[model samples]
Target: MFRGEHIGELVGNPGPARDAFPIEADTYERLDDEFYAGRIETLTASEQDLLLATAACTYPPLETADIRQRSAKSDGNINVLMGRLTEQGVLYRVQKGQYEYTAPKFHEHLIRRTGSLPR
Candidate 1:
């Protein structure tokens, strides 16, 4: 959400420090798309898979059991990967064995990507 890659993508300019930055043409219609996609892109396959499974549920503090029921990645390291997501501020621990996303809209984004209606 806060990356300079925005200017690079939109401006298509690679000027030095002395170059003037564009004051307009600075908006993206799909800010949510850019923000969340960039965030998901930073994760490993394990992390992304876990996250997508969790997004299958409408509510949180999610459990590994929840993911187990929804995904083929039952043996994925839930603890370590969830902890890494927590460290990245993507998720927060609700208890010893449950976690939830920090960004609220991310759930909807995942749902749309996976084409899975909330259950």
Candidate 2:
């Protein structure tokens, strides 16, 4: 954490006289991806919250119990909602009975639909 006044001291030499510097090409490219190419279709607040909650959990494979505890939604409702989210490519069926974030895997699909990658 170099402060404005400590930049020269920290570097053990005089710092650049110019205050503004251009970003490296790779860094600028990453910014472009995040700002434009990485944007996903806007999700409803509820869906976004669900995704975050799922990410927080460590339980092997999410079960109705997990939803009941974290989301407090009815068992049947959770099941139905999970199915819909998976079908929508927002969630991935990792195994016969497990799931993972499909964000990285289904990013292509999301990009195709929304014309941008998912955040």
Candidate 3:
């Protein structure tokens, strides 16, 4: 399920990557530069770790256990981190304990962005 009726809002202008299945690098760059950067700007290190953990999932829809396994920072404050991410529109609940990104390809974007970061 997409975020809205018009999918264009998320995947509209292909810019340069052109939606190449696994998602191209340029698309990630453009999306990060234009949209995700603003979204990521306000997150704490733990919250960003949560986002990366969610994106790195093998099957997705990460649960509390999954997050703990994936993130070293998934300590006592995990609930708080997840709650903050939800408040920021970075993630949404799919069920009682499962969560997914608010945007469809955002996880992929996170995965892509990870390779380019300083650490």
lDDT of each: 0.71, 0.52, 0.71
Which window of ten consecutive residues has the lowest lDDT sum in model 1?
A: 20-29
* Clashing pairs for predicted structure model 2, backbone only: 38-117
lDDT of 2 by residue, 1-119 (tens): 55788765644434553322344555545644664334233555555545445533444454545555667666676676677668766666766546665544233333333353222
Candidate 1, residues 1-119: lDDT per residue as tens digits? 53676565655445453254432223322644667788888999888887877767757567766766777654556767778899988988888777777886677778767878767
RMSD of 3: 9.5
Q: Provide the lDDT at 92 for model 1.
A: 86
CA shift of 4, model 1, Å: 43
Ranking by TM-score: 3, 1, 2
lDDT of 3 by residue, 1-119 (tens): 43455456556665444556456666667888888777777788768777776655654676877777777773678888888889988888888778877776676677776753211
Stretches off by above 4 angstroms in model 1 are: 1-29, 74-76
Per-residue error at 30 for model 1, in Å?
0.9
List the candidates ranked by lDDT, beginning with the highest. 1, 3, 2
